[model samples]
Each structure stands twice: as structure tokens, then as C-alpha cells.
Target: MVHKGNCHTQAVCAVATHLPARIHVILKEDRAYELRDLEGRPISKKDAKALIQREYTVPEEIRQRTRGHKKRRRRKEGYIRSQIRGLVTALQASRFA
Candidate 1:
């Protein structure tokens, strides 16, 4: 009696090669560049958003709508931020110890 077949064995030790990542710092949001346009003043949020949409492949309408929403929401974003903070603290403690 062959108890372990190809299906069972593959399922038991599935090695994910390229798992999708859930957390990422959007590049534009993460970095700031001196805006020489609009008379050397800081870029308006609206303008900054437009530039981001133009530079990146993101859809325009969605980007505009998402401006008010925080990346760190209490229901979803908050939980992820807490997890990241915990990991960072653990890493720091390990390094010091």
C-alpha cells in the first residue's frame, strides 16, 4: 500500500520561491525632492499627486481619491504597522544584546 503519493508529498513540503510581499513604502511618499517648479515653492499635495500618477503606472482617479486615506488605518494599516514596529524592536534588542 503506497501511503505517500506525489500529491501528499508535494503538499507536505511546498517551498514557496517568490511569495508576494504585503508591505512596501511607496517611493514618492518615502522620498522628497526639491521642487523647482511653481516658483521654487513646495509642491502642492494635488500637484505632487498628479506628478506621482504621471511618473508611475498608477491609475489617476484612484490616486486622487486615496489622498485623504492614511496608509496606516486602525482596522488594517494599524495592525500591520504594529507588527513592523515589533519586528524592528526585536531586531534592535538582539543586536544590542
Candidate 2:
């Protein structure tokens, strides 16, 4: 059985396996230009920040529930943060490592 965290890792590994060896060099040399060229548009820093914030921001319902219970709230927060961190780490490892 695949654990939740390993799902991200495995998916990254699968994609990375199919990529060319020169991908790392291209990523290092002109990462932004390469991405924009492929996408056919430029991405501003503000746009990138907004995209990330939108993707990673926790929902208000989860945040509201934390006010009701101490131990359960902490556990919920930890789980949420861990999942977010795991996704971020996996993405960084796949793209920038």
C-alpha cells in the first residue's frame, strides 16, 4: 500500500524517470525563460506568488474548527502542515534538486 506522502514522491520519481538528462542543465541555465517559452507567456513574480498562495492556502472551515478543541486542533494543524510541506518538498526536489 502507498502511504500518502510516498504518493507524491513516487509520482515525481515516475516523471523524472522519463525526462532527458539535459533537463537539469537546462533548468539551471535558464529556468524562467524555459518555463515561459514552453508556456508561451511570461509569469510575473506577483502572479507566481498568488498562484502558490491560492494552491497552498488552507480552507477557512479547517481554520475555524481549530478554535473549538485544543489537542484535536493541534493534530489537525500538524497534519495539514505536513501534507503541504510534503507537496512543496516533493516539487522542489523534482524541479530544483
Candidate 3:
């Protein structure tokens, strides 16, 4: 969670991950844990630093959205399978002939 000192009200930008909504409430508490700003209003900080952790689903989403390259391992497996299929087809054609 990031602090919003610019705003008059005690506010913070809560960035959440793995959440159903792109923007959501990330583990908020009703307690004054932070020191006040110059205006004497308390700084809006999270109770637990661990409260807002990066969501694994986010990177997974990026991986799904991006179609830049084929995974090397999968490509290798496909290549081997393709070679085996080609060899089998060739043998079958010869047997039929």
C-alpha cells in the first residue's frame, strides 16, 4: 500500500494481487498504526506489511496474454513426436506398397 500524502484526507493506494477485482481492498484494519503527517492527520499505512503481497495470478495472466515464443521443452517434445510419426507413416506406406 502506498501513501497519498498529496490528498487532504488520510488515504493510501492499496495494490492487491490474486484479487477478483483489478483494484481491491487489501487487508485493511481500523487502527492508527502510522505516524501523522505535517497536517497532524495520521499516515495511512497498512497494519501488516505482509497484508499486500504480489499475486501469483498476475504473472500467470501475463504469460497467458503474451504469445511471443513457444516453450523450448514443449517444442522439443513436439519435434520428437513429429519425427516418430513421420517414421511410422513412412513404414506404413512401404508395407502397403
Sequence-dependent TM-score of model 1: 0.25
lDDT of 1 by residue, 2-77 (tens): 1222233453345332222211223435655444343566786778677655653335455444533545355577
Of models 1 and 3, which has the larger TM-score?
A: 3
TM-score: model 2 vs. ground truth: 0.30
TM-scores for the candidates = 0.25, 0.30, 0.33
| Model 2 misplacement above 4 A | 1-40, 64-70, 73-97
RMSD of each: 21.8, 18.5, 14.0
Q: Go through the candidates in order and give the clash count of each.
A: 0, 0, 0
* C-alpha lDDT of residue 96 in model 3: 100
On the 0 to 100 scale, the lDDT of residue 3 in model 1 is: 26
Candidate 1 off by > 4 Å: 1-73
Clashing pairs in 1: none
User: Which sections of candidate 3 miss by over 4 Å?
Assistant: 1-70
The C-alpha lDDT values of all candidates are 0.53, 0.63, 0.47
